[model samples]
Target: MSANHPELLKLSSPIRCKILERVNKFKAKIEFDGRIEYAHINNTGRLREHLIRGKTGFCLRFEKPKKTKYRLFSIEVDGYGALIDTWIQGKAFERSLDLKLIPWLKGYRIIKRNVRLNKSIIDYLLRRGDEETYLELKSAVQRIDGYASYPDAPSIRARRQLRDLIRYVEDGGRATIVFMIGLRDVIGFRPNKDVDLEIHKLLLRGSQIGLEIRAIGVYYDLHRSSIRLWNPDVKTLI
Candidate 1:
């Protein structure tokens, strides 16, 4: 099938030397747990990864992926695992998006693929205001110059999520999307229009209508297995 989005400019591969170059520069310790668990603390989360870096590290952020679906996130190190968050990989960014953005959900339910709804399945199910919700997570990897963008790898599933959310809104259901920007050096999350314009248009429409589109900043302390919002204002790039 023909793609409707603009082609993003070429950049370094995900697993390329650039990754090791960045990781090796860190003098901090490593902390990452390969096992995935159920995301119970938040409504839009399914699993959390424990840091395995000899006890100390924090996430720095993530760069573009060599491919889609790898939990190939970047982290910072200091001494030992602290906040132990992040699970799975490619789809994990979506949860961090909600945890950082959705202010309304101070204490809500986060379930793992409890039930399949439509064409696209959300990683987490959030229940709030008596309505069962679906959520999808994405890692912010691609960027232009200094601008951070989504779909570090092209995702037909992502487009499906957008369409599904559009349908959810039409059906009187609540839905929100989180684009977790793992990069601390960047500002906000923008659609990689070069990669997916349909998604961009749908995202714009979702924002205009009822969909909650949020961009959460990540403060990675890989050595401590911790990530926090370093900025008060979560930026959203249209």
Candidate 2:
């Protein structure tokens, strides 16, 4: 976090578009497409006692209810699973996790570009001063006990993006991966080895090599209508 950082790097999400709004107790009056949908989500998983609002993707605050599927990409803690990333202000998740050094980007002008490398289209290319950055976004929706992972669900694209990121970094370019923690409670993001072994391996490899990994915790308050930074204790759930 820096004092003079560009707000363009961060994204904003409104509440009206969350997948499950007010999901702690029983959800009262859920609006869907002008009408209403089912209030209670039938919890079905080996996950602990925490209630996961949505299964795969993170919790989303809707901008226009339909402007896009989800206003923002985030996942909050519920009944069973541990709290993952929360309250992401903007589109920081797509930065490939290396953008933790935002303060470093302020001194120079940024040139943005999009190029296809390997089997995926890289989200963006950023060059400031003598530094060039390639980036992608990631989520830590789930984790395995022994191995620390990010994605809770299986993502082939995530694996591809990670591999691409590694390649770019392995080359002469400065690559960054941004893992946005959408939950207020998650302490860290692991690879979820039990669920996806390849993803787990990539995570370990990414850290082993030179991929910059940074995790931020977000807490959402509907009362004041704000999402803020928070750090909570996370225990092993393996």
| Each prediction's TM-score versus the true structure | 0.58, 0.58
Instruction: Give the local distance difference test score of model 2.
Output: 0.46
lDDT to native, each model: 0.49, 0.46
What is the Å distance of residue 25 in model 1 from its true position?
A: 24
lDDT of 1 by residue, 109-204 (tens): 675553565877776787756776676656664456666576544567778888988888888888877665545566566887876778888998
Candidate 1 backbone overlaps, count:
39
Q: Which stretches of candidate 1 lie over 4 Å from their true place?
A: 1-72, 75-102, 112-114, 222-225, 231-233
RMSD of each: 13.3, 8.0
TM-score of 1: 0.58
Q: Considering every candidate listed, which one attains the maximal lDDT?
A: 1
